[model samples]
Target: MIKTKCFFCKKSYTIDYSDSQYQKIKANPKAYYVCKKCNESMQREAQSTTGLDMDVIDKYDKFLR
Candidate 1:
């Protein structure tokens, strides 16, 4: 499993998705992973880099985040 930092607190954790998490995501094409603390920070970063407002940031961050 790969290690990634939590978007919320930036704490690192390895992905340990169960079969159910996989199936849930697979069944729902719109589902995605979120780094708890990093999400909002990352979203702002994307917006600054791309010249988008918060609304656009949220909309596009779904794809980029």
Candidate 2:
């Protein structure tokens, strides 16, 4: 596991070193990690503010993963 800090919350967390997301972050200096909690909160906020369908957001989120 690799130790890293969350981009939004600045909390420390661990991730698998070989994870694709870690590789992407390694390749891009500008890309920072967001912990799952922060990501979910942001997603919920976006859904509430934009009034977008949950299914649409879910589908897009899954596609990114």
Candidate 3:
């Protein structure tokens, strides 16, 4: 297991040695890791502030292309 701390919450946690995230972090020592809880919280906060639904943004992106 790879031991690391969450960048946002500063909580210590472990990542499985075989996980893709672990491999990425291993490749870059300066990479930051966000715990699942902080990641979900940030996603929710961002979505709430955006005011537009994800589907609408996706459709707009397709239309632009």
Candidate 4:
């Protein structure tokens, strides 16, 4: 089990290697793992914001390239 701390909420959680892509994440320094509650709240906040969703825009741009 790998113990991880949520960057947003400062919560400590454990990741089971069998259930999560722990090794892949460990290989990438830029990769992050957030708690489910924090992730859901962030998504909700993003949806409520005005203007284009930068996350979607970035994906679309990548798709076009």
Among these predictions, the greatest TM-score belongs to: 3
Winner by TM-score between candidate 3 and candidate 1: 3
Candidate order by TM-score, highest to lowest?
A: 3, 2, 4, 1
RMSD values for the candidates in order, in angstroms, are 8.2, 3.0, 6.0, 5.9
Q: Write the per-residue lDDT of candidate 1 for residues 1-65, one digit (tens) a residue.
A: 44444435757555545422344445654455455456667867987898978765366645633
- Kindly give the stretch of ten consecutive residues in candidate 3 with the minimal lDDT sum: 56-65
Clashing pairs in 3: none
User: What global local distance difference test value does model 3 have?
Assistant: 0.75
lDDT of 4 by residue, 3-64 (tens): 77777898877777663446755776346777778876886688678555656757764443
Candidates ranked, most accurate by lDDT first: 3, 2, 4, 1
Clashes of 4: 0
Candidate 2 per-residue C-alpha lDDT over 10-51 given as tens digits, one digit per residue, 9 for 90 to 100? 998777765546876666645788887888899789888999
* TM values, all candidates: 0.36, 0.69, 0.70, 0.57
Winner by TM-score between candidate 2 and candidate 1: 2
> Compared to the true structure, candidate 4 yields what TM-score?
0.57
Model 1 alpha-carbon drift over 4 Å, by segment: 1-33, 57-65
lDDT of each: 0.56, 0.75, 0.75, 0.67
Number of clashing pairs, model 1?
Answer: 6
